[model samples]
Target: MLSGGSTGVGLTARDELESTISLARTADKRGFHRFWMSEHHGMGAASVSSPPLMIARLIAETTRVRLGAGGMMLPNHSPLLIAEQFGMLEALAPGRIDLGLGRAPGTDGATAAALRRGADANDGFPQQVLELLGFLDDDFPSGHPYRQVHAVPGPWQAAENRVSTPTGTPQTWMLGSSPYSAQLAGQLGRPYAFALQFGDADVDTAMRLYRENFQPSDALAKPHTLVSVSVAISEDPAEARRQAGTSAMAMLRMFKREGYLLLPPDEVQAYQPTMQERHILDAYTDRSFHGTPETVADRLEDLHARTGADEVMLVVGGHCASLDREGISLIADHYAMPRSEIPLPVAAQ
Candidate 1:
């Protein structure tokens, strides 16, 4: 599971991210495979504008968990810059980095326009992805425009990346909520991750297409996949609903162009929702998996079996770090994930 550090309506921004790191320390010990953050800009609700910076901070704070972006909107910056930033992360924590790519701006139209000025990222995503790989691999073809260019920390690239070596590159995946990206990932022979958190996209069809069209390559001899979902689980069903409600309200606020932050379930309960709004909320809640750990795990297992997903990433619903951390512990326990025996640092205490 990953949190972009959803800063609640009244909470301080620092707490949102710092607390995720706090949870990451727990995730490190709990044997979670990876810790990733989302990239959003010009939003008061989310403080994770620079995922690379956060990933670096996470590397310094914990050991063992692979850190990277849930995605970085590639069109917003130079490909070489992304390569160098991740190259540095690979340098800091050799085999512990992932680079998930998303075409979405991760922001509103005005903000995205401001970020791109005029370039259309959606149109250039494929080319940009290839360019990024070339730089990261230092394999631009003969006489190519950027043939001579090399990403810094250039010595540590895919060619030299191995568990036997201290330096390694990130595990790259194309992230999407649609089949287009799924097909593209297959065509490129890269790993694919589909987001089922939104509730609207048909992840099953997308994943099926990815697997069907997959072309084996050096990076992956077969299709490697992961699916992301929105979930909230608790022994008490009502409590589970309340936790999931916070996320529903947060999303409602986002859609309405209102304030963008998680709201306590109490507030949501007290506020009067229109009939249509209530219906939407009800539908969304029904779509999410929630209950006891056993119940939730069973549902997740079914999803895993149905989608044939090699890995499952979660976006836990909550209003604070404690709720998210508790969610992590439950899921980790069910999966029998690894745990660290070391005690918390004095400062953390």
Candidate 2:
């Protein structure tokens, strides 16, 4: 996943976005199937404050690699606007777009209110999601009132507004760090991507619920899951730690108080980690794939098998710029897929 540099990390916002785009282009050249960017706000570290626009811009600049929000926090914006924005992106990138929706307030309450303006603060997110579906689906009759409200980047009311690819349009996925999102994905018959970065260890339970309760629908003939893994790789684990400092620290500040993710590796190498920091980081340790190519492969295999995930979406943190090229190459090689044909797979209907 592409992140707006970590909040307490050293890199500036501009650098984060530019570097993320550059790395994505390289990943396309490396044959990775999906490229997901994160969305956040009120956090000083990450500049990817807005996900939909970022995806739209990134899609315009790259050819392969399905682009989407690791997730768009649905509670932050209007369902109509979200549909319209993604509708336009889908049109531009065609089958390459993936809209992974999340129900959390991406930011704290104040920031959330500012984004939604005078809209209902407590508006039902589930109800909003249903409305969003109606906007994206073209089968809606012309007489529908929402059809008259045009989503600027794309037409929201018509099926024809879909993103066209050599084969078809973009697909949608549901993202969650908890069981709620997993169950919702199952009910909707959509693919699910879990967020393990927040140190959430209940992924197994969530995944199980998703698969077991999944109801077959026209969008999906069977169940599928994507597990998000935190990956940091370098020839030397020590060097990797240095690059991950700011991000590690950001996690520390937000979740703890003492350490930082952007600190020089040698410095943190000597200092002792507190029990709380250790606990928090340990929770995120599930798919902790770090080190060289050999190490990465082993971790990847283990994570895949443990999660029973059909795909493993990665979240690269800290000073990830320097590691992007090599990291993407290493991952693509481990997957055994050639550096071509990285389009989103056609979902079974």
Candidate 3:
């Protein structure tokens, strides 16, 4: 499951870290496949600006769960720097680090421009990804200009390439909400992950295009596809709708150009949307699953059947940490995830 490091009412930065750590521990104990953190800048809803920084902390705290960036925006930073950072992570964690790359800015235009230092935003997403992989693999072609440059502490060890190190390489993933990224990932033979959580995407169509166009590269032997979704499960129908309301309000505000600020549940309960908003919320409800464990699980099953997803990454949320944790716990239980050694008590209690 992917944790966006959600920040809710009265949640402090310290609390955000603690909650994420707690969630990671629980996921690790439950044997969840991975625990990825999102990267966002200048956003109130999410607190983590540097996923790699948090991942470094998480690696020391959790023993089993694969920790990674839900994505690091490729347009916002240098590919060589990312290779060094993730390479370091692989060195520390061995087989447990994943580097999910995205083309979006992950922030407001102003902030994105600031992060990129006025560089061209749409210039070269696919090229940057290839550069990053080349750095990670230390395999630049002979004619490439930057071929001599190497990411230190990288996959390659020794001065003259005569020796090797046991430091594992991070698995590279391409994450997107659009067909462009899907097609690129397939053509490059990288694992493709689609963000269905807050995307206006045709997940099945995207996946099909990816699989049909896939070409094996050094990173992958065949097409690998994963879907990310947000789930909200509640036994009480009212509560489930309430949870969906928060997300709706956030989207409503965004649609109106107000921004992605999340309103409190009480405020959302009192909100009345326009005809346009009503349509948007209905579409959102159909895209995501919100109900009891059984109901949500069935929806996820159908989603998988439709998308032919090799894996589904749950990007969950709720009004608060407790509720969010409980929602994730419910889904985990339905999937028969073993109880964490350090059970999720804040939610359970």
Candidate 4:
């Protein structure tokens, strides 16, 4: 997943947002199967508040790469709206759109409250997911409140127009950092994405739960798991650690509720951390995959072997766009991912 997030060390919001496009193009050219943007609200460091809008822009710039929200926080918006947005995206990209839904707020408590408008939306995530599926498929049960309200540009839209979209609706995946989400995804028979970068959740346990509880669905015959991890790769191991430290510092600040902006490695080195802060920072850095491409690749391979994840999504951490892109290229080269001969299309200015 090429996240729409930046460290915000020395870059403007516009620079970071535009850099996401460049990164997406690189991911596409290098044959990364999916390029997913994340949704984060009221965060200075994360400029992407709307994944669908970014996906739309990416669709125009890249060819062959699957574009998706790595994910959209479901509690913040109406399920029908999400259905319509992703439904339209599926229409545009055919088999290339994924809708990864998460129950978390993806923001602080105050920001989440503002987004939810005093409603307790998180608890209804499962129901909302079902409603969203119903809207996308137009298959609500009789007497259901939303049975008559169809999501335009959805499967119903194609049927109404007699348009043949053999590619089908947007592929939905469940995203979470806990067992609850793992079980939910399994019960629904949806692909599950465990975000190991954000929290200290046990990937082994989560994957076990997902597969053990798995039920077959139309989209997937068996359990499909994607593990997303934070990674920073460079020719120099020390340089990779430095880049990784920038993100670790940013995460530390967010944990302390101080700020979300990422500082440069120099700044991170200059500041003296408290003993407790050092422990927290170390824990964050320890779980991340950082070092030379060979080292990171070995770690990623080990993780995949342990968890049996169908896909491993790298949350590449770096202080600059060039570094991030370079890290991506290095990892792709290490894995021997196929590259496209066609040049990436430049986004409209």
Candidate 5:
């Protein structure tokens, strides 16, 4: 099934945030299975600093698309608090909520330090995942320090002990671009999402490790996996590449520690790249899928065949809101995704 991933990139935070809502609505109408927003702090290129808040907003705007964080960086906050926030979200949307957890800081060192306040929480990601799961399930072992703690509005609060319809916990997913997270997700039997959009080179190895270590758990019966890929699709291949170049430029800036900014396509086309910068951009472009809908769809199909991923999450790329939405629509059309008959709800005045 097709899904979407957004980082809310635009010229301004307000515009980017609003664009995300619009994109989510479009994704829902186009029959995309899920729509996930990413969390990034102190990045000018990305407006979403809190995926939970964005997810909640998207939930209000869309009718049936699964809403979630592409992920919430676990080390940046307390497990109990996350459990509580997501629990409330699950209560609000029932089976439509997803909580994809990740181990990275989701920002630069300085910003990460500010967020963590000198805590070395990244090293304890596995423990935190367990703690968060415990809170969500309200099933911590006896004598555990947090045994008495409960995430209110959690799965334990389902009416009549029901696990369907109006009562259910958020579907939990493990998001990562590395082997550590892959193995952990497998060991815990959670659905794993590999962030291939970021140009991670170890996708094959990571996927292998995850399946090898997978263990059945209450949350999952088999090794479920999704690979998030960067995509730029258009009727014209050249136009698609032009749009994708902007993202490559942003990646180059980020690698240089110059901060991330998605320059407009015209500006990106005019800029000159040094040999090293050119290498970075070329590598990113090579790994990303950008072309006409036919080409991108074929690449995605090949990816699934190679990795055996259960789903392919597209991180549609472009320098503007319209192009991003267009890319999503084009892919859906190419795949013959069923269109939703439900119209988007009108916003309040």
Candidate 6:
């Protein structure tokens, strides 16, 4: 089932992060399998500056759900560090962690440069990926005998509180909005997560390409596709529309803004949108699985069955604050649980 954490915008970034963790923990208690967060940089709209770090924190906070970076931009940092950080998290959280890597810098050129630690413009991504894989495998031959080198905090030990790391590396995934990413994920035998929040310009094509190019690895013997969508679910469609409206307007505003806009839920209804807002909202609206739990569940099931996707992730409450405990209750009861048999804990105050 779909699950998400906070994107952390404005003054609420930290608090939102906590709330997201709380929410994900609650969802985990309710049986959602995975919980993820997106990565972003330097736009006042959302504070997803360090998704890996945030994911590590989330791993610490939740129990059963797999914690993942909806994506960490690959080009922005050293792959070794990414491997190390995720390796530690994998060790800490074991089977319940996912590493979703992306190729984009997640920011514009200058900001990308600032994040890159002075690396030249053409740093090798394919090579970096290979190196990362090497590190994940202890048999990579980088070192041996006298001084063996393996990923620190590798999945060898089973801590009392942490789950065992499934006798292999963390489940690796690739996130992209393009066919190229689909091809790459397929070729690498990793799961593919499409950023439907951006736009599904070629979603079907991407999925087809992924399945066509797929090569089986130890982690995935076949192709598994996941699509991420922005959704605002509430009993009141109009209220949901109004609440997610600011985010819709913010998205419209981004055509001229320096960075992408991911408007928060609280700001949706109160903000005045521009003339182009209707068009922007409509475009994403086609993809959003909103409405009541039954309606949303029907839409979600249709999307999954149509795509044959193994899973879906929704960014709920992005544009509306009206969704609360009861809304989540509805989702947990009907949409998230396998048989609607699992009882969710009382909502956290």
Tens-place lDDT per residue, model 5, 47-137, is: 7889988887887798898999878999999999999999889877878988899988889999999999875768888999999999988
User: Please, what are the lDDT tens digits per residue for candidate 4 over residues 10-111?
Assistant: 788889878898888889889898888888987778888999998998888888989999899988989899988988888788899999999888889999
RMSD of each: 2.7, 5.5, 3.3, 1.5, 2.3, 4.6
Local distance difference test, each candidate: 0.82, 0.68, 0.80, 0.86, 0.84, 0.67
What TM-score does each of the candidates earn? 0.93, 0.82, 0.92, 0.96, 0.94, 0.83
Which is the winner by TM-score between candidate 4 and candidate 6?
4
* Model 1: per-residue Cα lDDT at residue 338: 68
Residue 36 accuracy (lDDT) in model 6: 75
What's the lDDT for candidate 4? 0.86
Candidate 4 local Cα displacement, residue 7, angstroms: 4.0
Writing each residue's lDDT as its tens digit, candidate 2 over 1-349 gives 3333342256677877777776677667676778887777776656777777778667756777788887887777777777777877876777788888887766656676787664564457666666677666633557877656645444333334464422233477888878887888999898888877666459999999999889997778899888876677777776655555535555665655333335544554455778987665444443356667668778778878899999877677655576756775776676675776444323201
RMSD of 2: 5.5
| Per-residue accuracy of model 6 over 28-109 as CA lDDT, tens digit each | 6677777777667766655657777777666656557788787777777666678778888876777877878887876666
Give the best candidate by lDDT. Answer: 4
Tens-digit lDDT track of model 1 for 203-301: 888998999989998678999999888878676778888888888887777778885668878998887989988987787777777777888899889
Instruction: Report the backbone clash tally of model 1.
Output: 0
lDDT preference between candidates 5 and 6, better one: 5
In model 6, where do residues sit more than 4 Å from their true spots?
Answer: 1-11, 117-123, 141-149, 155-168, 258-277, 317-326, 336-349
Measured by C-alpha RMSD in angstroms, how accurate is candidate 6?
4.6
| Candidate 1 residue 317 C-alpha distance from true site, Å | 4.2
Candidate 2 overall lDDT versus native? 0.68
Model 2: lowest-lDDT 10 consecutive positions: 340-349
What C-alpha root-mean-square deviation, in Å, does candidate 5 show against the real structure?
A: 2.3
